[model samples]
Target: MRAIDLETQVLAAVERIRKGEKTENDLIECKRAWPSNNKARQLAGSLNRAAGDAVIYVIGIDEKDGSIHDTSDTDILDWWSQIVGQFDQVPAEMVRHIDVPISNESVVGIAFSSDRAPYVVKTGSPKPSLEIPIREGTGTRTARRDEVLRMLAPAIRVPAATVLESNFSAVHYPPLASAENAANDYRREESVHAFGTADFFVEHDGRDLVTLPTHAMDGIIEVGDLSFTLNVTPDWFQSETKAPRKEYIDRQREAVLISGPGVVPLRVDVEGLLLSHRKLLETTNSVTVRLHLGILHTSKPLVIEMELNTNPREHQLPEDLNRWSVRGK
Candidate 1:
């Protein structure tokens, strides 16, 4: 999962607990204090297998009363290590952690993606044994023979998407490089001082998340069917300058393919979006843009929406110059 998504999921889990919406089940678990090593292994294994997409294991919330508690006694790394060290067949590194603030105190929320299901936990004791635990509603138990086989065969496979960069900003300055006569009354177009880019990636392997089987990824989620749109606040801005739109269709410019176990990036450059839009500076000092990207990662059509803004005031020229112009010697 992306960092933004992880933070959102963890916070939502904490909120559900506080609201007393429901007891812990297949997707969420809570604890008032840190758990023992044995308990950590069981929770990790059960939740990892049960969560179809993702799960949040939260700390510092009373499972019984749903009251917030301080998790400052130990940091997140220590908590992660306790659970990770107990997994024998599961990929321990797939687990991610976040800190959730409540009132004046804070709680630790652990996020796990279930792309790699059927996790096996190693029990500790004289009669140590490896077991595949799964969560069924509010309780957990060892997976039956058929359940393990079902998890082994992925029912759905979709590559995960994440934002690499989402930024838009501009500077408005009086013409500085022009040498034309200032006395002319006709309106002159201003050079584009705004710059921005929206970039994101899609990964085929577990390097970015829990990996889907190579065959599964190949059979599902064709990269060629992907389409995207860049919506500008002033629609005229995009219509007037169609270079960016054309570049998107030109396959030679941006190459995205699911060739092997790797990732491909889709980038949009909007530095010159206001390049030729007449009165762009006079009409508005800022511009807003939104990207609606389409991809088939979960065997369902998924659209990722990201918005960016540009502030021309932040890029204005210094006060020493009222209007920059070339002085004819």
Candidate 2:
């Protein structure tokens, strides 16, 4: 019942079908190449036959890479409305339509429930019939008439009052003691900063330029005895600058690698390092060396900021400082 993106959801649906978790015939693919009205009607008919047990999902309007490109000339909201109307003609059915955003594309999910009688689809010149079964797979036959009837059969609805409830237990919770122990024992914080070096060479250029780290400008050498190394690309750098000669502004396109004792190696994007570097840079005009660490997420990357000041004139700080420690507002 959950609405999902067509590209991602379709793959899941396919997985379910392949595993026999869900019937493959229940899925349908509608592409922009086909007639929209005809496809809509076919989908409507399929829904009617299954009485609301069937789910019709759409895909392929977006590009093959699953990027969203607006195709329909009409308003999407209006088009969705018309799609619902067409399916509503099916008798004794409740249809639920949902629009899911996947990447740059929009995927529509239609779930139909038939609570009353057998669903029927109206084909050209022929009256509504129950023979048209929902297809579960490519080259697979539709559900048989008897099988469809069985699915449509009205079973006694179980009352919630009759269902037994069990007491909840905290045993399923993640061990708090283990987490607390880890937090208490291994407590060290670190920060990172990303700076562009002119000496770096470009490997390739397309959407983003691939460059290499230069020994002269890279900031890791400044962190004395903290024990840090690049976790991502040791030699290569991804440049975000569209034009090479543009003024060196601290943009979010740069990424850096970082690793140290008790800290997991990570690749952090430029933005994360800047946020961490803000305080140090603002406080002192004297150039302080720092390592830019990138933290990769499911969708994006984050930067960790660590500072190293080796100036003999300035106050010497503790060697084992916790970089993860946050100052409270």
Candidate 3:
């Protein structure tokens, strides 16, 4: 949704919660106020219950009378710290808070995306606090082994997509290095950026949530600590099949940055790129180039894979940069 439509959509959601018409389903929840430290213990479990749902928690609404508060003065990070239980486990964007008006009073509204759910949510306080929780009707309860499996289903995938599709989600490209500005040596600062949208789905899913066919990336949720690895393969023709070449793309890239709180658009650059591009051309002409990207995440990385093919694509031949340009979806 565009920025203009987001708040309006949020207000509608808040209205649903206030009217007593919303259910405690996979996507929505309600809370009376920012919780006390003791009540904060339930926040982690609440996150787990959401799984890969576009979970919303409406706060400062009186449960008995569905009343809104006069104002919401609480810091969003305070509630975030309770739900995430750690630093860098979840990006700030995944969690959103708004002060929405309902009649004469206002309510604090919080939204969470399940893309990063089912990971270990800890407060770093003490023992017995590490237990994962799942939603049981309107309340949260400790998850059983089987329940844990259901939540963990979307995070772990068995295979990678060899040909990129409309729903695959991660899109990346090297920036413009036009003919008039062509250079033999790739500067250290030059980089390629991958922008992921709602279309790019997270892989792991347990029991499917309530997703419409029109919905993009319906069940794919964000996991934590993301970085990517790339592999490039050139089209092999008359030369020799036995000596076809392969290169790990990141080795040529200097750094990897993923977007998060305080990080809007992340950027990474190609390292020793001049040398890598030179080697690619020696292998084959640009009939087609196969790109294999690995979306790896977490402190201990778990990879979500994507494969793509670019046709009629630019091949920066070592002999000339006069004809170099790139375009891909």
Candidate 4:
């Protein structure tokens, strides 16, 4: 995410939020209301929810009582810093990026990305605080104990079956198959029997067969038949396997190659899988598995070539195998 100008920055930030791609939190409209302790606390709370990746922007003119008020305060920077420092007293260190202009009275932007672990914003006496992470719909909420624990837990790699069930809905590709049941045989299946879950299943109507997961649906690209299953551990969960061996395959570079101009090569070295069991954040049950794939050049339609294991985890639930219990479901 690169911002060439203020307008571009704002637009890009909003786009990321809408696409669920934002790594940090973001706020619009700054300095409308006069500064107060409560306002400061609210700002701190928003920053905290970002989990070290958050940005806030003060937009447009401040019109109060139907009058345009020009902000000419030169000491505004110092005042803002003082408010941010209030969080440190609660034993939470907040580092933010500040950008203000002498001529632009309409906009102010504040960006925060904490390098430290989770920070809490104190609200009342005895220090009742709220943990921070980008909220799904309303933008940040006080995380419950279980949610906090899930985030703090060590990374583990487990099978998908341990958490998810084998059930799915289907769709067809290409406009020719857009009819009610045209090409409906091109079906896919989604299984909750794993660590991280995926949506968008394709069901086969004729043979009653379902295609394996594919990158077209999510990050997964199926390589084999549905009957073939692997025995692997779920990522980012308490598991018996401490370290798992890396699996490699001969992937066709053309199928997953990315190319473009002005693109830099980037590499990610995933140590352990970063899996998330998120409920209420989205419309469906989701599990995310993080893995480190080495560096590659940045290109449009980024291509990834790898074989991933799709296996059920070692755990079982009392519900139907097709449906697994999820939060906010």
Best candidate per lDDT, number?
1
Each candidate's TM vs. the true structure? 0.45, 0.31, 0.40, 0.36
TM-score between candidate 2 and the true structure: 0.31
- Poorest 10 consecutive residues by lDDT, candidate 4: 155-164
Model 3: runs farther than 4 Å from truth?
1-10, 13-23, 86-93, 123-129, 155-329
**CA shift of 56, model 2, Å:** 3.8
Ranking by lDDT: 1, 3, 2, 4
Per-residue lDDT for 155 in model 4?
Answer: 20
Error of 2 at 173 (Å): 38
lDDT of 1 by residue, 37-64 (tens): 7775557555555535666677788866
Better of 1 and 4 by TM-score: 1
Candidate 4, residue 176: the lDDT equals 40
Q: Output the TM-score of candidate 1.
A: 0.45
Which residue runs does candidate 2 get wrong by more than 4 Å? Answer: 2-25, 28-35, 44-54, 59-67, 75-95, 114-117, 126-133, 139-144, 155-329
The root-mean-square deviation over C-alpha atoms between each candidate and the true structure, in angstroms, is 14.6, 23.3, 18.4, 18.0
For candidate 2, write residues 1-329 as lDDT tens digits.
44443345555544454354633353454443323543445554455344334445544343233334344455545655555454334542324555555455555544545454344433434444223434333432345767566556542221111111111000011223565665885433334343221111111112322222322122242222232233233334356678775322112224322221111222322232323343443343232224432223211112223333223332223331112211112
Better of 3 and 4 by lDDT: 3
lDDT of 4 at 257: 21
Mark the 10 consecutive residues where model 1 has the least summed lDDT: 320-329
Give candidate 1 misplaced runs (Cα > 4 Å): 125-128, 155-329
Question: 1 or 2: which has the higher lDDT?
Answer: 1
For model 4, the local distance difference test gives: 0.33
Global lDDT scores for all candidate models:
0.51, 0.35, 0.41, 0.33
Cα lDDT tens digits for candidate 3, 90-189 = 4323446666766777766666655665645454567755656666766667789987776766642222122223211122234446754445445333
